[model samples]
Target: MVTITVTRKSQSFVAPSELTPSEMLELSAIDRVPGLRHTVRSLHVFRHKDAADRVASRPAEVIRAALSRALVDYRPFAGRFVGSVVAGETCVECTNDGAWFVEAVADCSLDDMNGLDYPLMVSEEELLPAPEEGVDPTSIPVMMQVTEFACGGFVVGLIAVHTLADGLGAAQFINAISELARGMDKPTVTPVWARGLIPNPPKLPLGPPPSFQSFGFGHFAMDVTSDRIAHVKAEYFQATGQYCSAFDVAIAKVWQARTRAVRYNPEVEVHVCFFANTRHLLTQVLPKDGGFYGNCFYPVTVTATAGDLAVAGLLDVIRMIRDGKARLPLEFAKWTSGDVKVDPYELTFEHNVLFVSDWTRLGFLEADYGWGAPSHIIPFTYADYMAVAVLGAPPVPKKGTRIMTQCVEEKHLMDFKDEMKALF
Candidate 1:
């Protein structure tokens, strides 16, 4: 196992320059509807290279300057959350309050860290900026940490308020920072904050519904190689005479394996929820270029019983997921303020739920700062939910996807590992 020694260097705020817009940015209905109070966290690891002498020597100064410039365009991130729970609207105020930024040093080299089969979760957290004090973290909206390793490599950890952006939205923000760092004029896709584009929902209930309450779950990770994914897709095609997407197959397998791993009784209910991208699905409302940033995906959920899943074949599961995804357009069409009555965020993570987020298509590998594209992108943590993050690997020998998951039961963890390996 690789060990990491992290030393926090500086803790400060990075505010936008006078050039960027200065005003309060309100949360859209999509952001406030679920009343979810958590940040979506991500990590990007860059390997040390002799060529990256500039980045390694002054990592903090370079990143801090770039972040300040980037914040000028993404000023909402520099703002703090102002509205209260009882106020009915919680908005982000762009007072140029600044995002919490941290700099750190790690003990091991990039190879030493990646040498392990699974990335170190403990070290990943250390690379993230500490949560803000005095005010709600969401107010800060975005927090970041850049940690340089002994071998010249470094990792960047980010925690963004989900109310602001989903995976893609967050990627867009990072890409902008990267572009500025690389001396580009601006991001290729300028962020669009047409919050009204997302239909507003009626006043939400006070807290997460009873069914959405947290359950003690142990987190774990399972690696899925390109070969394994291809094998499953081939199996699906042969069995059903129809093609299946990598995501459809990978998610189905995890759902099936996890259901069986836990040894749930045949009649026990189970659910699989996917965060489906709606940028294309809602073209009528969204820009064709899909340049509009903010949360644009909807959670598409399918439910079953342990017995039902046990009896179902792989094709059956794929079809189920397909159908659920196909319904997003209709869901959006029928959406209204009253739709909050069935808030998807609550349904997205109801107890015992298997929530899968596919980041393979999100272009994380292209997230290049001045140094170069990240060698590895890892999701460090998820709040109050058991999640499986499917990420795309960098351009390398293996050319595949990596599945990192939050904890489940101990026995189930072993079973899931064995089951995933057997798929190949």
Candidate 2:
């Protein structure tokens, strides 16, 4: 097993400027979703191939200074999430309190950390910073950690209160920090808060998700190679008379295989829920300012029977997923205008539910902070059995797809792997 020991060096609250006043920003209805109230973390590891010696000397100071400047425009991150019960509904309060920053050192080289065979075994808590006990999490929506390794390379881990931003929004903030580190006067994209853009649902659903019998759980990585993706696209075109994206192909396959792996009863209902990006998808609905700095996508669910999914052809599954996504525009309109009556509670996870999200489009490798882009961007968080995170392949080949799934049974995990390889 690979082990890393991290020693805390310094801790502080970094504000954009000494004169920046404290203020409160309200969170959107999407941000206040039940499942999304917790913190979401991103782990970025940069290996300094040539300047390790120079970087090791002042890693903390460099990142801290950059972060302070980056917070100037993204001041909301330096605030807390305040909640109040208004007429039986939960409302969010965002108050500027300064983001928590921690500096640490690991007694290992970047090579040593990366050489582990089972990457998930490494302890995530030691790498990322979190809110201290007795301190309210909402008070510090953003927290960061800079860990210097013995080999001169370093790791940057960030945890943001989900109420503050989504994954893309978090990337924007990090990129801004990187821009400042590289001596840029300002970020490439301006930050904007538009939570009121989407109105709350008219009614909230009160119910627990369906239940399933206990079973084995495992995490597996599936590769969607360039050639394999091309083949799938071609097959989809032939069968459906249309082209589908790599994401469509990959998600359909996983959803199909998972139904079989878990031995879900043929008569049981199953759902594949997807998180779609509406930044560009709903150009007519969103303001022309471009993707705002908050949760912009909606969780859309598609339903089918386990037996149906198990037997359905790939093209059909692809279309099913694609068509479900295509309806988001009308859904968004209905949702914003109170025509739709749904709440986050209704989207809870269950045995028959499989959630799929695509992170491949986000440029995780491009946050260049003077020392070039990161070599590895790993999600050190554990996923439950009913979830799939679709990410782009490593920086090298740049043509394949990578996925990390949560909680599959031991035997089913192997079968899932084989199924994925067979699809390619």
Candidate 3:
């Protein structure tokens, strides 16, 4: 019922002039480091009829206006990763490849878009979380349409570079768009650009930012799905087991069992790195909802192998991850300009990624444009070994967990349901 009108446009999504000193420092860090111009992180979904109708009536002028305002108001651009130092986004668009646009492949039964990859796999064995008590199903981000098909189904998608913002960051952007549609003012909190988190690059500095090689092996760029993935989670608690969420408990037990099964060197700096937004550590604290909307999450990590962690208590694992998150503020040393050059590291991994993102709290489906909010949003559209999307689902008896996985070890993935039974 609400309407929004766009009245302004800016060349870059972010007005570099508005950046505070620290924010500039943060942005500067990105400039110093090289970025991966390709393989942007994006999410896509297919929409049904009524929703497509609502989108169809919406003019590109209004939508583009809304997007521009969203860019300025929320500035998803601010959180994006400029290309790598060696193979970064071209300083100019004409010189740049298709690096600026979010690239997604949607291939349904139809053949409209030149580069759309359809849903390759769908499974009935998996479960879905029930939509919250009263949320509309169509408003979900995964349900938005990139381009409506002649058959009436619509394709919608989201592209985010891991270095920029992760699932939480993308979710915040979607929610802001919804708020704009309702004519809401700028979010109460502005985004704290992480660039400032980096210390001033050395007087001369180590040239540009570190490239992918400086960190580790090559990066990941695949398309995964349920049909392609093999994963399973079960709800279980032993009479003597510790109290914890299913993820914490299961991972703990698995680690314990795995370590006992193998030998690991204690000297190794192995860790479990998960997200906990470090917005406050940035140069400036924007409004609570700065840039995007959602809870400020931080990456929680721990160092343990199959055996040690698997045998740990539930409360213990929770406490450990909590402590790891608290230490996030310590990482602000980059802002302080430590001796080590700033190198952004992505927590995602191939054949070994464990994402425990809670989408319900992300406010993704709550943000409605003109028509309504998205009913469902799912990650793990790429090919992979293990990936989990923790969002609300409707069919499971209790809250359900949707796991997506792809790997050479089909046995490890196909044994998911059995693993759930074992975890229980």
What local lDDT score does residue 56 receive in model 1, on the 0 to 100 scale?
40
Q: Which sections of candidate 2 miss by over 4 Å?
A: 1-3, 51-57, 85-96, 115-118, 136-139, 200-216, 281-287, 380-386, 395-399
Alpha-carbon deviation at 85 in model 3, angstroms: 2.3
Clashes of 3: 80
Candidate 3 lDDT tens digits, 206-315: 34432222212111112222221122212222332433343444344333323332334443333554555555665264444455332234445566544445456544
Q: What's the residue-level lDDT of 128 in candidate 1?
A: 80
Q: Candidate 1 at 132: error in angstroms?
A: 5.3
Worst 10 residues of 3 by lDDT: 92-101
Q: What is the lDDT of candidate 3?
A: 0.38
Candidate 3 ranges with C-alpha deviation above 4 Å: 1-65, 72-145, 149-153, 163-166, 181-270, 280-289, 292-300, 310-320, 330-360, 381-400, 405-408, 415-417
Q: Estimate, for each residue in 1-424, the C-alpha lDDT of model 2 and write its tens digit.
A: 5576789888878877544566566677777665666666667777765655344446677778889887777877766555542322334333445779999998888778652223544677888886677986544778899988887677788777666677788788888888887778888888877777655666555455434345445777756678988988998898878889988888888888888777888999888887776677556656686647788778888889889989988899999988998888888667766775555334654666777756665666788777768766766444443455445455343558777676467878877777777776
| lDDT of all predictions | 0.71, 0.71, 0.38
Alpha-carbon runs more than 4 Å astray in model 1: 1-3, 50-57, 86-88, 115-122, 132-135, 201-208, 211-214, 336-341, 348-350, 384-396
Question: Estimated TM-score per prediction?
Answer: 0.89, 0.89, 0.54
Q: What is the alpha-carbon lDDT of model 2 when measured against the actual structure? A: 0.71
